[model samples]
Target: MTKLLFIEASPRKENSYSSQVANEFLESYKAANPEDEIERLPLFETELAPLGMEGANQKMENIMKLMTTGSGIEPEGEWAGVMKEIERLKSADKVLLSAPMWNYSIPYRLKHWIDLVVQVGASVMVNEKFEYIGQITDRPLQMILASGSPYENRFPLESDGTKTDFERAYLDHIFRFLGFTDIRLIRVMPTGMPGPQLDEIVANAKKEAKEAAKAF
Candidate 1:
């Protein structure tokens, strides 16, 4: 059985288009593959502590212990609670991430989880030949995104972040860094726009979710 990890990054629960669509997709996927090993992780419900110097030191110590014993180790620090979160990422065969774009970027909580999970030896590694040995799970990486505005139209410039397509670049780059070659990005865009546009976008999102469930 494949291990499927669904990570929800949206802070909004009820009105979140991303969450609703993801739930629909997951329900269909579960019905199709009843024996699949599936799990859900909601980032908004989790307390993601920012990395500090003390936490960094403790994480380093944990890494050392893991290297020596080849066993999972949790360090005592601000990061103590996040260790299990990291382990779950490493154990997954397939990963699905859902998040709504905030201020043209990802939510801080999701970024914090990324910081905790994407480790040196676990997610990525450097070989002796100075080449990169990416340790990412050999599975499909999927991202479901909801945006209030149409950032996809404009080009991203460093000066003005308005044009930036944050969800696509950020998540895709991270997954690629960890060795996932294939990525599926589904977007429900321009949500804040009024009238039939919103309904149209949601309808399209639902359709996409149903189609993606088959692949998942």
Candidate 2:
């Protein structure tokens, strides 16, 4: 059976627009692929240890050892936790990320998770020419993003003309760097400004999510 890893980065739970839409997508996906194994990873509940100085040093030491001795040392403590997350990502056939934009970017816990998993000699490699190569490939990644403002087609700049809306851009670039070939996005907008049309907007987003699930 196909293994689908669902990473939830929203802490708002039932009150979160992204989570609501993601739930709809999951329901549809289950109907389309009933035999598929779905694993839910909620960032708020997951015990993701920070890679402090010790963990960082261990990773560098392991990389050096692998390059010279063709074998790396076993990970321990927080480093082992990082390796577990990396292995989980590598084993997944497909991935789904549900997140709400926080200060024009991803949540802190989500970023923490990324830092833990995107490791050299684990999820990526550097060639002799000093070029970076991604190890994980041929997998599809879908992101369900929700934003307080209409950040989707807003020219990717702030009022002062600085770069903005790192939510989609960052995730797309980083995941592609990690070798996700097929990346898809489903967006919900103006979640902070609820109006009379909010219901319709949410309904439409849910409909779009369900349609995407059919082909996912």
TM-score of 1: 0.84
- On residues 152-193, what C-alpha lDDT tens digit does candidate 2 reach at each position? 543365562443797888899899889888999988887777
Off by over 4 Å in 1: 59-83, 153-155, 158-161
Model 2 scores worst on lDDT over the 10 consecutive residues at: 154-163
Give the alpha-carbon lDDT of every model. Answer: 0.78, 0.89
Model 1's C-alpha root-mean-square deviation from the true structure amounts to 3.2
Clashes of each: 0, 0
Tens digit per residue, CA lDDT, model 1, 25-71: 88878888888898888888976666788777766766677667765
Worst 10 residues of 1 by lDDT: 153-162
